[model samples]
Target chain A: MPFSISLTVNGVSRNVELDDPRVTLLDLLRERLDLPGTKKGCDRGQCGACTVLVDGRRVNSCLALALSHDGAEITTIEGVAQGDELHPVQAAFIAHDAFQCGFCTPGQIMSAIGLINEGQAGDDPERIREAMSGNLCRCAAYVGIVDAVIEAQKRLADAGRREAA
Target chain B: MKTFDYVRPATIAEAVAASAAPGAAYLASGTNLLDLMKVGAARPDRLIDITHIAGLDHIDWLADGGVRIGALVRNADLAHDPAFVRAYPAVAEALLSGASAQLRNAATGGGNLLQRTRCAYFGDPASACNKREPGSGCDALGGENRLHAVLGWSPSCIAVHPSDFCVPLVALDAVAEIEGRAGRREIPLESLYCLPGDAPQRETVLEPGDLIVALRLADPTAFARHARYLKLRERTSYAFAVVSAAAALAMEEGRIRQARLALGGVAAKPWRARAAEDILAGARPGETIFRRAAEAALADARPSGDNAYKIELARRIIVRALTLAAAGTPQRLPALPASPFSSAPGARHAA
Candidate 1:
């Protein structure tokens, strides 16, 4: 018999079947929930196509089992923005042309936002590059990825300053 | 991946109970195991997920000034620990140089130590890899063995250890605290990995019911202060190592008091360079000492095909690491300014 699990994903209470707790959260999202924004690349974790925010901390969804995350809040690419306004990361990515094929874009954006929120983002290019090491794009579009992150930080700071002014 | 029974135990005892079962494997972060399962390399009949066991993910101060890190502690947490950065920089640096942010956030201390080799032949489903199938003949012996072992290999298998963390732990003389059906005991990190003499099927000495619970690091030493880990990967990051070295040096008035060395990407297990250590002890730090130490370490090196580059590459990595360790410490900035293009990910030279 499959076990029943209760989870809060994208701020909604949900019930699911978990016969095999070894099924990665990525599998649950893409296979069961039909949220295909999380791509599966190198299913072995060599690539970061399946990044997601678990309780606001970015993790590789393909490596984390859905069962172990009971009661934890999860936010995917689907939950990043309001209905009309895109999140700053998404907007910056679009502005800077951060992606080519758009397969690994969601993961890269999620990771960058998580880093900025975690206070791991810094002005140094190396730390930014080092922290962004997990996400790989086949088109080798790292230059644009870094540019998008820097631009997002600047935009957020500018918005904060304007609101205070 | 084969369908298997799974349990997420809320308590350590329950997790251990599940892990004690025959054919049951304890799942930490599951970064490595899950990946292997997807490729049809590892299949466990039962997986006992221990990520929810809260207390097992702590880093406590030992009464003896050392640190006891829980097996389930995430790699990112350990890498950024202030005490680890101050005491054993090599270990902190090793953890930082591996995988990437998201993967390390999900990779556990136990899982990092037990990660499998990246021998291309071993991972390919069609190839004859003795590690995957015993007595199935190792095609890597006469095949495209660009990542095969240069040390601690036999006629059977030549797969290199792929971890960036275990290399430094071996040099530090760290120990593992494990609990299982047989109860709790500590083993040296050096003896944890087994060299493939003939039976390449076996990777570690871990029994069927053993579960790694903690890793205990020893007190800081002069050698630890001068330690460094340098990795040369295909694209500088994310990719596995083409050649890497974890080395520690002790110096007095330009004379080497003691030096410890270990090689990765060139060995079946993290190769402990006792010969190089002995040769460089109390020796001067210069081209002569570096050349001889490299020669002694690679004296028995056996490379195949395009991997011959690793012979020189591994030597250069060792020399560069040792040179930096002996040459000079980085100037302290007003604040911690992260390096932009460091040769190694975690070589923060300081007091």
Candidate 2:
């Protein structure tokens, strides 16, 4: 049975036909839609390499079945930046050198964005470390990741303040 | 993962009806369920996706000071709810302490209660697990069973229930509203989990096609002022508790009027320490009384495997949790949430 579902992926609406119910959002994005930026690390929920924004919240796309998210808006790594302008989190990751192999970079960036939007961790390094503990970096880049998140949060807050002013 | 027929039920009634078939399971967030399927621990032929069901995502404050939390309410949302946090600080703390931010964002309250144990043998199909397959021999009895249960265990199975959120709910005497093929009914949250006695596979009391709609906590304001959830884990965060405790006290003047205590990672269910609560009811707040309460809490705890250390750890945690609760809940939750280091003197200052 082919199930047809509609989703708004990275600001574009897409209608998809899933031939198997076992197809996860990670596979749907990387394989069918050709959005390969969302890396599949564990395929299980243990690793956050498959993290993405579903309805503005970070979730493990590998654990999310595509059919379950019909009509929902999703934001992946491919949607985080404007043309020729990097998102604050992405820019901060590069500035801090937060990645070595860059396999977990996409998930870390998306999780950082989600954490910043949640507004729970505000320049607190401990809080940022705790919040970003989900996206593990095997390269031992946690020091850089924490610094990057703190810097990105400050940047995003400053940008918001400027817009408000 | 096995290919399954997915049905998105529009209503709870339809969901319950669709789940009546054999080899059918309810799919909410799939944080735990999908992982189990990927490991071949769970193989359901039909999945009834109940995430689309409306009216099950609300957190309603009842007129009688109680609160009803819908089954579909995400763990992160519930933990971050200001009013809910104020009323049930221990619950919120416990919720925040369990999983990572992303997992908490996707995991639901009802699904948290139903999450299976993290026993390595149970996740491996090659190993014999009584909880996974009833008649199969228990491999965890002799395998790497350092983190197995200590309070309640039988020769059949020793896997502990791995839910941090449930420990505080059981301590608060939360009630579960369930709907089934027969009708709607309510049961105490403590009664929902069954001891692994002989039927390890039948972990919960829910029958087939039974769905948990909401969890109701009755008037938690009395203990809200002095409630604390303290978890001892291998790491500071994103780790399961080696032994965790939730302690809430309603004090009168300088004496303890009432106490609620429960332990996690020690038994098949959140082991409510009724005897410990009884011992602390009229006692003065001190280390001596707290020690007695801790001893009473672990009086029946016996190790199932190489986890004799957990019994002592559980006792010390109960004592520390009671002491922390008597001190009072923090003005805001600690940056580390329920970790013991969070409440260490000068810990926040050092941070």
Candidate 3:
């Protein structure tokens, strides 16, 4: 039996017709939605390579079934940039060389954005590293990733302060 | 993942009724269940999607200063709840210590309690795991069983419960409010899990279709002042504990009025050290006494496999956890959360 689910993907509301219930959110995005930016690393929750914001909270899309997340607002890597202007976290990743092969970059950037939104790490480098531990980089880009997150968090905070003032 | 029919239940009654059928399982965040499904460990024909069920996502404060946490409350939300963190700091710390930030954000309170063991043999469908298949004959007994349980394990299974949250909850005497086909009932969280005896397949005391609606925690303000969760993991973060302990002390006039201690990653359930707690009550807090309590806590612990070192590690952790708890919980959680290095004076700065 096909299940119908409504989702807002990258600010665009989508009413998807699922042919099978076995389709995970990751598969739904990559296979059906024509969005391939979200990499499937482990295809399990262990590796956060398939991370995306479901209803503004970072979750492993691989483990989430599409039908279960009906009406969820999803933010994938493709939506991170505004036109050609890269998101702060994405630009920071480039500046800090946070990727070697660039496989884990999308997930790392999404997770960083989520962490900044979470507001738990503050400007603490160790906290940022700990918070970002979910996304693994086989290329050993952790040093660069941690630095990038710390710098991006500061920039976001500064931008917010300026907007408020 | 196998194809299954997903039913979104609007209420608790509907959820129970839908889950009453064989091969039906309630779906929460799917952090654990979905992973298991991918590995062919859990194959449910029908999924009762209970996430949409109303009135099950609250964190209510009772009049008696206790708390009633709905089953649907996400792990991150509960851990970061300011009032909850203040009252049950150890529980918050334990919650923060387990899994990654993403898993915590999606995982629910009830799902945490019901998470299956992380034993490699049980996760591998080809392996002979009595827990996965009754009477399959335990292969973990001789095959890379270093991480097997050190206590409360039977010949049928040596797997340990992998929940970090349950360690402190069991220690603090949390109660589970369950809704079954018959009616609602509450039980001590400590008794919720059964030791993997002859029937390793039957993990929890929950019958089929029994839904854990909420978990009630009585007032723990006395222990709040000196409560801490200390975890010794393979890494600084995002790893399960090799050995963990939750210690809370209620002190009176420089003497311990009461103590609660529990160990994790050592048994089929969160191993509450009632003997250690008994030993600490009315006694002055000191290194010698703490060591005695640690010894008492591991009195019956014998390694199920080659991981005899875990017994010693569990003992040391008990003492260190008690010491940290006696010293007092930090004004705020450490940057590294429950890691042993977090307790070091300049660890965060050095990092």
Candidate 4:
């Protein structure tokens, strides 16, 4: 009862075998592909600790079945960094000390990256708060997380200006 | 998750045939089904994967201003579409208020409507939930009854429907466009959700072989401009509501013309407050009338001992929601509902 799913993970073509009907993309990454950066916090959809990008939108991989994502282009936390360079949002998280214990960091970073890329995280502080509300930091360090997003947007704007110049 | 056979069909006809057998459930996004499977609540021996169905992801707007949202339409797409967010803000808001951005990205509009209850008894493997295991007896009646239903409660079941999107659909008079082996049927969104009577297991009216093709909605009227979804929850994000109200009102010169009132997190189905609507139809939109309407809405609310607070909270939510919808001054929700513990939006939840 196994089905073969053709999907691209982090820009690489993959033909993975899917069985069990309930085996999710998170399992395909953590167990099969050994890309464990997408942590399974709740396994249930309650926790956003397993967020990844399917077709450039953030999704809780823990609940996304592998077969459902066949031929989908998925991006995990591991794919955010290009070669040795860090994605601006990831670098900002570290610089701002946005997380503690760091269990939820990968999912947090993934969600933030998705928001920034989607252009939903705007200049308004309230909008930033609303956009990032999904990624929960149990440490309750939301102020830092908000600051990190603002800084990330500023850095992107600055980078855009330099490129234009 | 238990082992099961998986068949991914590329067409609705193929999917319908594949799911005709017993214990074969239609697989969409698996955001909800997978969770049920993981907890042993749902043990579908076979899952017919219909996500591969071609052209099922398209959202088509009819020339009559109606919207036809494919069952495969992701919540993220519904939430972000300019047409939906503008014309049907209540639907968009409901989609956005559900789960999280990440969860919504994977959860389809069909899956969101079909999500089971979040009652503690239903979710926990060891607890006795009649909805989870029919005739097992609902332990929620005595144990952890705070989050249980206040409306549409029977001895057999007390669980609430967990979809945030269905509330708005109920208010908007949406229809479920479904197809199956026999033929197709258009079920009113209101009739699509069944209240838990003796059998609490059957959440939707969908037949065994039926495949939900799309959630169809009528054209938005000027009344839509005043429509909004106001939810009372613990956190500002990714939370279910303690009591959520979706109100669509058409006001004519500071007075109520017609109003639709639907309540969530307080009933087995997305509970529509018809009596409240009757009270609001001709009355002037004021706090006093709103309170009276809220009273009418909750007049029949039967709350378990531990969850009686939900009765009051639910009444307040309906009042506040209707008031705002009447005035067309949408209230910015301070906190989303479904915060169990923590210094969140008032310890006023749980009923």
Find the candidate with the highest lDDT and give its number: 2
lDDT scores for all predictions?
0.79, 0.92, 0.92, 0.81
In candidate 4, list every pair of residues with a backbone clash: B232-B337, B233-B336, B233-B337
Cα error of candidate 4 at position A110, Å: 1.0
Shift in Å, residue B214, candidate 4 = 0.9
lDDT tens digits, residue span B1-351, model 3: 677888999999999999877799999989999999999999999999999988899999999999999999999999999999999999999999999999999999999999999999999999999999998899999889888899999989999999999999999999999999889999899999999889999999998999999999999789999998988888788988898999999999999999999999999999999999999999999889999999999999998889999999998888888888888888898888888776553222221
Candidate 4 C-alpha lDDT tens digits along B176-244: 988977888899988988788998888778888988889988888766777767777766666788788
**Better lDDT candidate (1, 3):** 3
Where is model 4 chain B poorest over a 10-residue stretch in terms of lDDT?
A: B337-346
Could you tell me how far off, in angstroms, the CA of residue B271 lies in candidate 1 after the best superposition?
Answer: 1.3
Q: Kindly list the per-residue Cα lDDT of model 4 for residues A1-165, writing each as its tens digit.
A: 677878999999999876555678898999998899999888887768898989888888888888778889999989989899999988999899999899999998888888877776566676777777777778987788888888898898889889999
Inter-residue clash pairs, candidate 1: none
Candidate 3, which segments miss by more than 4 Å at Cα? B344-351
Scoring each candidate complex against the real one, what DockQ results? 0.58, 0.86, 0.83, 0.65
Candidate achieving higher DockQ, 1 or 3: 3
Q: Residue B262 deviation, candidate 1, in Å?
A: 1.0
lDDT of 2 by residue, B249-336 (tens): 9999988999999999999999999999999999898889998999999898888889999998888888788888888888888899
Which should have the higher lDDT, number 2 or number 3? 2
DockQ of 2: 0.86
Candidate 2: residue A105 Cα off by (Å):
0.2
Runs in model 4 lying further than 4 Å from the true structure: A18-21, A160-165, B329-351
Ranking by lDDT: 2, 3, 4, 1
Tens-digit per-residue lDDT, A1-165, candidate 2: 999999999999999998898989999999999999999998876668999999999999999989999999999999989997999999999999999999999999999999999999899898888998888888989999999999999998899999999
